[model samples]
Target: MEFGEILRLSFAAIRGNKLRSLLTLLGIVIGVFSIIGVMTAVQVLQNGIESGLSNLGAHTFQIQKFPVMASQAEWLKARNRKNIDLRQAEYVASRMTHALYVGIESFDNGETVQALSGEKTNPNVTVFGENPEGISTNNWTIAEGRTITAADDRSGNRVVVLGKDVVSKVFPRGGAIGQEVKVDGVRFTVIGIFEPKGAALGGPNNNFVAIPLSTFMAYFGGNRRSLNIMIKAKGPEYYDDAVEEARFLLRTVRKVDPGKEDDFSIFSNDSMIATFNDFTKYVKLGVGFISFISLLAAGVGIMNIMLVSVTERIKEIGVRKAVGARKANILSQFLVEAIVLCQIGGVIGIFVGILAGNLAAMALELPPVFPYDWAALAVLICSIIGVIFGVYPAWKAANLDPIESLRYE
Candidate 1:
């Protein structure tokens, strides 16, 4: 028989039982959707994070009290470690010969900031206490006025640098440079405005205020307050040596035992990306396993549906056999029908999954990601599932006894 004839018969059989075919198709769609949706979302978040991390000035890294991303057990252990204070950070900063600049910073978050003129920001605004050197270390460019000076840090002056979002909210008419804004009810005169940095890791990046580290400790410091030290190397060639010098300086200042591990974490943009990737590995593994099981179950559903289709069409199969239709043609027809159903389901599943994942991207203000590799894999997997599950029913239909089938009630 011609391939066109076989295809026509296959489509006709599927059309004959619309409800059943649709129900069977759903299994495949669900299986594919689960895998594609989760992976696509993961990739989008990963892209956003990488983009954000890249903005951390070249040849720079931060020394913090704990890992940016850590498991519960790791966090618990880190919580017990001694906090790295302003004194300790400064000690490391002073002795690091390879470092070009070292920045001391700490933060308080979720503070409602109010402008003296009556405008205000939401409680989610992040307030950072950073030294003047942080302007370079953190890759912040001044858009207006002047940045924090060494005197600001030493005197604990109530000066603030506003991010673009904060500037827009408080000084909508544009003179933000010297405006007095209340940060969590404390009066701080705006000293500068920072260039806008877009959303990062699917969250707002420009909704922040920077104040001198000394003033920050005066208000927000407690027994648990810790400092993060950002260091920038003079050049790319000096980066590793600078980081090593900083590490040794910290170890010596903190008096860490020679045999013990360092209490703090040192990380750069590359390391941050690596840490995030490690976290996503578990997510991928778990979702991949669930998808595998779901696909197997979906394959079983396909087989069951095909078997029923073969049984219902026994008389028709007999008529075709008696009219000299070959067994190969009968087998091909059933197999093709099953494949067509799976392909349709797979296509629909891919479309829905991509749409669902990109919706999250849109909300995060990040660019959408199309995982072409996964889509191609889904198509291949669907074809394999069709062949694996459709073979038995096709064989059964092809082997029917024409004379007995013809006499069926």
Candidate 2:
């Protein structure tokens, strides 16, 4: 038989048993959808996180009382560590030789900011208490006027730098600089507005307000609260050296015993990315295991359905063989039928999976991903499942005696 004749017969066979074929297709669809949907979403998050981690400027890292990435289970231990106060941070900064700039900062979230005109922002605004150096460490660029100067930080002056979100909400008018905005009932003179940083993994990057570190502590907490000491190296080559220098200085100043671990945690952008990757590894593994089981079950369903097809078509096979059809031709026809079934399911799964996966990206404001590699892999896997499960059924139909099959019901 010609290849076209075989394909036509294969599709005709599937169409003949629409309900059964659909049941088999359902298994394949579920398996492939599980794999593709989860993988595509994960890929999107990975891209967003890597970009978001870049919020920390190059050659910069932070030493804080808490780890950059930690679970709630470890929160109690982290909370128990002694606070890295401004006094201690200053002492370390005065001695750390490798760091070009050492800045101190702390923040409180879920506070409201209001303009003098009574225009107010949502209660979700994050207010950062930052030194002048800390402002630079945050990668905040001045779009208008100027950032808080060292003078503003020295005397706990209530000067502020507004993120784009704050400015939009509090000072919607053109003039934001020189306006006074109240942060948690404390008034601060807005000295500058930082260019919008867009959204990050956690949320909007430009939805915060920054005041001098001293002002933040004076009003929000106190000078004794834990501070994140931001450190910048002169270049990438000095990055490690700067961290080590800061660590040593902090330990010496904090009087941490030599044999005991330092109370502080230090992390850079590279380390943060590595931590995030480690977290995602388990997610992928769990997802892969689940998908594997689903696909395995789907493969079994394909084999069962193909065998049923062979049984129901006994007389047809007998007639074809009697009409001089070769065993190879019979085998090829049944095999094509099985393959067509899987491919149909695979195509549907891929389409639905992409749509479902990108829904998460839409929520996070991340760009959609095509996941070409995964789509191709899904297709290849479908073909493999078809071949692995269809072989026995096709071979059995091919080996049947023409006379016996014709005599049977």
Candidate 3:
């Protein structure tokens, strides 16, 4: 038989059993959809996280009483320990010579405020307290005025820097510099306005106030110790060396023995990424298991449908053989038909899955990502399943005795 005739015969056979063919394809559609959709969504989220992490700046790390990426239980335990106050921060700075800038900052979230403008004051803002060095450490940029100076920090000056949101809420007319905004009843002159930093994985960065470290300690005293210390490595090449120096210095300050684990935690950007990756590994595993289950069911459905097709076409096979049709021709026709069915279903499923994944990502406020490699793998898997499951039925039909098949049916 010609190749054209073989293809025509295959389509005719499929057309003869439309309901059965659709039922077989349905399993494949569901299986491909489940895996492809999840993978696309994961890809997008991973990209967003990496972008946020990169924004943390280069050659910088933090040393604190607590780890940067700890669970709630670990955080609670760390909070209960002795605070790593400003004294410890000073000690680390005095001892460590590798770092370029060592900044100490302690902050309280959700601090309510009263922004007064002749009785039209607002009361929804967050306040932060940090030294001059916070500018480089947090990669914050000044939009209108100067950042807090060293003299400002030392004098405990009641000066404040307004975030973009604070400026809009308190000074809607746009000239907020040198204006006064009250925080917990203490007045502060707005020294600068920070450009919007947008939202980070931690939360919104444009809803807070930044005051001098001394002013913060005096106004909102919490053991006069440091809540967190940010250190900038001298250069990218010396980041590891700086971390080691900081660690050694902190251990010495904490009076930790050389043989014992360090009491304080040192966290770098790489460590943060590793922590996030570990957390996502379990989610990936769950997705893989569910996809596996669906694929297995689809494979079984494909095999069962192929066997039925073989049985229904027994008489046709005998007739073709009587007319000198080769066994190889019969085998090729059935094999190609099975593969085409699966490939079609897989193509449709992949497109639909990607659409669904992108929609879900948008709803979650994440960027959309297309996983070309995953889609290609899905297509390859469908083709492989077709060949593996279609073989038994094709072989049986090809080997049937023409005389017996024709006589019996």
Candidate 4:
């Protein structure tokens, strides 16, 4: 039999039972959509987070009471351990010879600020306490005026730096530089304005006001000790050694026995990424298993429909055999029909899946990413399903007895 004849018969069968074919394909479509859309969103979020972390500088790492990216319970447990105070930060700075800059940062609760420039009072800002090293440590750049000096930190000077949004909201006309703004009635001269550093893993960067750490600790009633210390290695090659040395120093300082785990957490961008990747591995595996189940069900449905088709078309098959059509021809035609149905379903599913995933990413305010590799795998699995499920029904139709089949009603 000619290939054209086989294709025509296969498509005719599909066209005749349009609703059943569509229902069978629905399972495959939903399964593929769920898997593809979820993974795409996950991949996009992962990339965005990694890129954000990368902007924090690979040469820098932080020593803190807790891991920066752990769950709440773990974070709380770490916090309950020995607090690494300002003295410890100073000690680490004094001891480490490989670090170029070591910074101590401590934050207090939100304080209200009233910007009074001839009754132009703006009162919505979160104030922080930082020093010269904090500027370089937090990847902040000054837009106007200079960052707070070590002299400012040492003398507990009441100088403040404004973020871009705070400057806009308070000054409006760029008149904030060298102006005095009062935080809880303690006046601070605005010595600088920070350049816009887009949102980080925490929140928008433009809504903060920074002052000297000494001033914040004295007037704002915070624990005078530092909760986090940041260290920048002198060079890229020295980063690993710096981290190891810092860990050893911290362990010795905290008095952790050699046989016991360290009391504090040392974290960097690499550590955070490793933690996130470990978490996502299990999630992706579960999604893969779920999608496979749905695809299997769809395949089974296709097989059942193909079997019904063979039973209903027995007389037609017998008539074709009586007219000298070979069993191979009959088998090939049915198998091709099943595969074509699945290929069409797979195509539709892939298109919808990609569209849904991208739309979801936009809705969630994350980057859009295509699951190209996973899509390819899904298509390959669909094709395999077609071949596996179509074989038995195709064989059943091919072996029909012409004499008995033709006489059946």
| Candidate 2 residue lDDT tens string, 35-99 | 88988999899879877877788989988998878998676788889999888999988887877
Kindly report which residue pairs in candidate 1 clash with one another.
none
Which pairs clash (backbone N, Cα, C closer than 3 Å) in model 2? none
Q: Name the candidate, 3 or 4, with the larger lDDT value.
A: 4
Please provide the root mean square deviation of candidate 3 (C-alpha atoms, Å). 3.3
- Candidate 3: lDDT of 213? 82
Per-candidate TM vs. native?
0.82, 0.88, 0.85, 0.83
Q: Relative to the true structure, how large is the alpha-carbon lDDT of every model?
A: 0.88, 0.87, 0.79, 0.80
How big is the positional error of residue 403 in model 4, measured in Å on the Cα after superposition?
7.9
Q: For model 2, state the Cα shift of residue 47 in Å.
A: 4.2
lDDT of 2 at 286: 92
Instruction: Arrange candidates, best lDDT first.
Output: 1, 2, 4, 3
Query: Against the hidden true structure, what lDDT does model 2 obtain?
Result: 0.87
* Candidates sorted on TM-score, descending: 2, 3, 4, 1
- In the range 329-395, model 4's lDDT, one tens digit per residue, is 8899889888877877887887888888788667656667888898898788877888889989999
Show the colliding residue pairs in model 4: none
Off-target runs (Cα >4 Å) in candidate 3 are 1-18, 51-55, 71-73, 118-124, 222-226, 315-329, 397-409
How many clashing residue pairs appear in each of the predictions shown? 0, 0, 4, 0
